[model samples]
Target: GESVGLHLPTLSVQEGDNSIINCAYSNSASDYFIWYKQESGKGPQFIIDIRSNMDKRQGQRVTVLLNKTVKHLSLQIAATQPGDSAVYFCAETQGRAAGNKLTFGGGTRVLVKP
Candidate 1:
Protein backbone atom coordinates (compact mmCIF):
# COMPACT_ATOMS: atom_id res chain seq x y z
CA GLY A 1 0.00 0.00 0.00
CA GLU A 2 1.08 3.56 -0.65
CA SER A 3 1.17 6.25 1.99
CA VAL A 4 0.98 9.98 1.33
CA GLY A 5 1.33 12.84 3.78
CA LEU A 6 1.57 16.62 3.76
CA HIS A 7 4.42 18.48 5.36
CA LEU A 8 2.11 20.85 7.17
CA PRO A 9 -1.38 20.51 8.57
CA THR A 10 -2.28 24.08 7.61
CA LEU A 11 -1.06 26.90 5.40
CA SER A 12 -1.92 30.57 5.70
CA VAL A 13 -1.67 32.79 2.67
CA GLN A 14 -2.43 36.42 2.24
CA GLU A 15 -4.95 37.27 -0.37
CA GLY A 16 -3.28 37.70 -3.73
CA ASP A 17 -0.16 35.92 -2.55
CA ASN A 18 1.11 32.59 -3.74
CA SER A 19 0.77 29.40 -1.74
CA ILE A 20 2.85 26.27 -1.88
CA ILE A 21 1.81 22.93 -0.43
CA ASN A 22 4.14 20.01 -0.09
CA CYS A 23 3.52 16.30 0.11
CA ALA A 24 5.52 13.09 0.32
CA TYR A 25 4.62 9.59 -0.73
CA SER A 26 6.04 6.31 0.52
CA ASN A 27 5.67 4.32 -2.67
CA SER A 28 8.40 4.88 -5.17
CA ALA A 29 6.53 2.76 -7.68
CA SER A 30 3.69 5.25 -7.92
CA ASP A 31 3.79 6.87 -11.32
CA TYR A 32 0.88 9.26 -11.23
CA PHE A 33 0.05 12.00 -8.77
CA ILE A 34 -2.88 14.39 -8.39
CA TRP A 35 -3.64 17.47 -6.34
CA TYR A 36 -7.17 18.04 -5.14
CA LYS A 37 -8.94 20.88 -3.36
CA GLN A 38 -11.88 20.24 -1.08
CA GLU A 39 -14.15 23.00 0.17
CA SER A 40 -16.27 22.72 3.22
CA GLY A 41 -18.85 19.98 2.84
CA LYS A 42 -17.76 19.34 -0.71
CA GLY A 43 -15.84 16.54 -2.32
CA PRO A 44 -12.32 17.00 -3.56
CA GLN A 45 -11.94 18.86 -6.83
CA PHE A 46 -9.07 18.17 -9.18
CA ILE A 47 -6.44 20.92 -9.23
CA ILE A 48 -3.48 19.58 -11.16
CA ASP A 49 -1.54 16.38 -11.83
CA ILE A 50 1.87 15.17 -12.81
CA ARG A 51 3.30 11.88 -14.02
CA SER A 52 6.59 10.36 -13.01
CA ASN A 53 7.98 11.14 -16.44
CA MET A 54 7.24 14.83 -15.99
CA ASP A 55 8.84 17.11 -13.46
CA LYS A 56 6.28 19.87 -13.59
CA ARG A 57 2.79 20.57 -14.85
CA GLN A 58 0.73 23.75 -14.83
CA GLY A 59 -2.99 24.37 -14.99
CA GLN A 60 -4.90 27.60 -14.67
CA ARG A 61 -3.11 29.44 -11.85
CA VAL A 62 -1.99 26.18 -10.37
CA THR A 63 1.13 24.08 -10.73
CA VAL A 64 2.01 20.51 -9.79
CA LEU A 65 5.54 19.24 -9.42
CA LEU A 66 6.77 15.68 -9.09
CA ASN A 67 10.09 14.52 -7.70
CA LYS A 68 10.24 10.78 -8.09
CA THR A 69 13.71 10.50 -6.64
CA VAL A 70 12.47 11.68 -3.25
CA LYS A 71 8.87 10.65 -3.71
CA HIS A 72 7.89 14.25 -3.16
CA LEU A 73 5.03 16.18 -4.71
CA SER A 74 4.01 19.80 -4.47
CA LEU A 75 1.16 22.05 -5.50
CA GLN A 76 1.38 25.80 -5.97
CA ILE A 77 -1.46 28.27 -6.18
CA ALA A 78 -0.92 31.69 -7.64
CA ALA A 79 -2.55 34.82 -6.26
CA THR A 80 -4.35 33.02 -3.53
CA GLN A 81 -7.90 34.20 -3.00
CA PRO A 82 -10.61 33.73 -0.43
CA GLY A 83 -12.26 31.16 -2.62
CA ASP A 84 -9.06 29.20 -2.64
CA SER A 85 -9.46 28.38 1.03
CA ALA A 86 -9.86 24.65 1.32
CA VAL A 87 -8.29 21.39 2.27
CA TYR A 88 -5.75 20.25 -0.29
CA PHE A 89 -4.70 16.67 -0.78
CA CYS A 90 -2.15 14.88 -2.87
CA ALA A 91 -2.94 11.42 -4.23
CA GLU A 92 -0.81 8.80 -5.89
CA THR A 93 -1.63 5.90 -8.16
CA GLN A 94 0.77 3.12 -9.04
CA GLY A 95 -0.56 2.15 -12.46
CA ARG A 96 -2.34 3.58 -15.42
CA ALA A 97 -4.68 0.63 -15.63
CA ALA A 98 -8.34 1.23 -15.03
CA GLY A 99 -9.64 0.66 -11.52
CA ASN A 100 -6.36 1.66 -9.93
CA LYS A 101 -7.09 3.19 -6.57
CA LEU A 102 -5.60 6.50 -5.49
CA THR A 103 -3.79 6.75 -2.18
CA PHE A 104 -4.56 10.18 -0.73
CA GLY A 105 -2.60 12.20 1.80
CA GLY A 106 -3.88 13.40 5.12
CA GLY A 107 -4.59 16.80 3.60
CA THR A 108 -3.47 20.38 4.38
CA ARG A 109 -5.87 23.19 4.99
CA VAL A 110 -5.16 26.39 3.11
CA LEU A 111 -6.44 29.56 4.73
CA VAL A 112 -6.72 32.69 2.67
CA LYS A 113 -6.49 35.91 4.61
CA PRO A 114 -7.82 39.16 3.36
Candidate 2:
Protein backbone atom coordinates (compact mmCIF):
# COMPACT_ATOMS: atom_id res chain seq x y z
CA GLY A 1 0.00 0.00 0.00
CA GLU A 2 1.21 3.47 -0.83
CA SER A 3 0.52 4.94 2.57
CA VAL A 4 2.30 6.32 5.57
CA GLY A 5 3.40 4.04 8.41
CA LEU A 6 5.54 4.08 11.50
CA HIS A 7 8.70 2.07 11.86
CA LEU A 8 7.72 1.19 15.40
CA PRO A 9 4.32 0.73 16.96
CA THR A 10 5.34 1.72 20.46
CA LEU A 11 8.11 3.59 22.21
CA SER A 12 9.09 3.76 25.86
CA VAL A 13 11.05 6.65 27.33
CA GLN A 14 12.11 7.88 30.74
CA GLU A 15 10.21 10.87 32.02
CA GLY A 16 13.14 13.20 31.58
CA ASP A 17 14.67 11.66 28.51
CA ASN A 18 14.23 12.66 24.93
CA SER A 19 12.08 10.55 22.61
CA ILE A 20 12.03 10.10 18.86
CA ILE A 21 9.22 8.70 16.73
CA ASN A 22 9.76 7.77 13.10
CA CYS A 23 7.38 7.52 10.15
CA ALA A 24 7.84 6.38 6.57
CA TYR A 25 5.71 7.39 3.63
CA SER A 26 5.54 6.00 0.14
CA ASN A 27 4.13 9.12 -1.46
CA SER A 28 6.75 11.18 -3.20
CA ALA A 29 4.33 13.96 -4.05
CA SER A 30 3.54 14.83 -0.49
CA ASP A 31 4.75 18.35 0.21
CA TYR A 32 3.47 18.97 3.67
CA PHE A 33 4.04 16.89 6.79
CA ILE A 34 2.44 17.24 10.17
CA TRP A 35 2.85 15.55 13.51
CA TYR A 36 -0.10 15.14 15.83
CA LYS A 37 -0.49 13.99 19.40
CA GLN A 38 -3.64 12.28 20.62
CA GLU A 39 -4.28 11.81 24.28
CA SER A 40 -6.68 9.20 25.63
CA GLY A 41 -10.23 9.88 24.45
CA LYS A 42 -9.14 13.19 22.97
CA GLY A 43 -8.69 14.35 19.43
CA PRO A 44 -5.31 14.68 17.82
CA GLN A 45 -3.56 17.96 18.59
CA PHE A 46 -1.10 19.45 16.16
CA ILE A 47 2.44 19.34 17.42
CA ILE A 48 4.43 20.61 14.47
CA ASP A 49 4.70 20.66 10.71
CA ILE A 50 7.33 20.94 7.98
CA ARG A 51 7.20 21.56 4.29
CA SER A 52 8.91 19.21 1.86
CA ASN A 53 11.31 21.98 0.85
CA MET A 54 12.38 22.35 4.45
CA ASP A 55 14.51 19.74 6.16
CA LYS A 56 13.46 20.52 9.70
CA ARG A 57 11.08 22.50 11.89
CA GLN A 58 10.91 23.12 15.62
CA GLY A 59 8.22 23.85 18.14
CA GLN A 60 8.45 24.70 21.82
CA ARG A 61 9.58 21.27 22.95
CA VAL A 62 9.25 19.35 19.73
CA THR A 63 11.15 19.03 16.48
CA VAL A 64 9.97 17.68 13.12
CA LEU A 65 12.42 16.51 10.49
CA LEU A 66 11.70 15.54 6.92
CA ASN A 67 13.95 13.52 4.64
CA LYS A 68 12.65 13.65 1.11
CA THR A 69 15.40 11.47 -0.26
CA VAL A 70 14.40 8.59 1.99
CA LYS A 71 10.74 9.57 2.36
CA HIS A 72 11.17 9.50 6.11
CA LEU A 73 9.94 11.77 8.86
CA SER A 74 10.70 12.03 12.54
CA LEU A 75 9.45 13.85 15.61
CA GLN A 76 11.59 14.52 18.63
CA ILE A 77 10.18 15.38 22.03
CA ALA A 78 12.44 16.92 24.60
CA ALA A 79 12.26 16.04 28.26
CA THR A 80 9.48 13.53 27.81
CA GLN A 81 6.95 13.96 30.56
CA PRO A 82 4.14 11.72 31.83
CA GLY A 83 1.70 14.16 30.29
CA ASP A 84 3.37 13.60 26.94
CA SER A 85 2.26 9.98 26.84
CA ALA A 86 -0.01 9.60 23.85
CA VAL A 87 -0.44 8.15 20.39
CA TYR A 88 1.51 10.12 17.84
CA PHE A 89 0.68 10.24 14.17
CA CYS A 90 2.38 11.62 11.10
CA ALA A 91 0.24 12.96 8.28
CA GLU A 92 1.10 14.17 4.81
CA THR A 93 -0.61 16.17 2.11
CA GLN A 94 0.33 16.92 -1.44
CA GLY A 95 -0.39 20.59 -1.10
CA ARG A 96 -1.63 23.23 1.31
CA ALA A 97 -4.79 23.87 -0.68
CA ALA A 98 -8.19 23.56 0.97
CA GLY A 99 -9.08 20.30 -0.75
CA ASN A 100 -5.74 18.61 -0.33
CA LYS A 101 -6.36 15.27 1.30
CA LEU A 102 -4.28 14.40 4.30
CA THR A 103 -2.98 10.87 4.70
CA PHE A 104 -2.16 9.67 8.17
CA GLY A 105 0.20 6.99 9.37
CA GLY A 106 -0.87 4.16 11.65
CA GLY A 107 0.48 5.94 14.73
CA THR A 108 2.93 5.14 17.52
CA ARG A 109 2.11 5.04 21.19
CA VAL A 110 4.63 6.73 23.45
CA LEU A 111 4.86 5.54 27.05
CA VAL A 112 6.62 7.81 29.45
CA LYS A 113 8.04 6.11 32.53
CA PRO A 114 8.50 7.96 35.77
lDDT of each: 0.88, 0.89
Which ten contiguous residues of candidate 1 have the minimum total lDDT? Answer: 1-10
lDDT for model 2, please. 0.89
How well does candidate 1 match the true structure in TM-score terms? 0.90
Cα lDDT tens digits, model 1, 1-114, are 222223548898999999999999988889999999887767789888788999999999999888888889999899999999888999999888886999998899898999
lDDT of 2 by residue, 1-114 (tens): 222224547898999999999999879999999999987777889899999989999889899999999999999999999999888999999977886788999899898999
True-vs-predicted CA distance for residue 112, candidate 2, Å = 0.4
Candidate 1: C-alpha lDDT: 0.88
- Count of backbone clashes for each model? 0, 0
RMSD of 2: 5.0
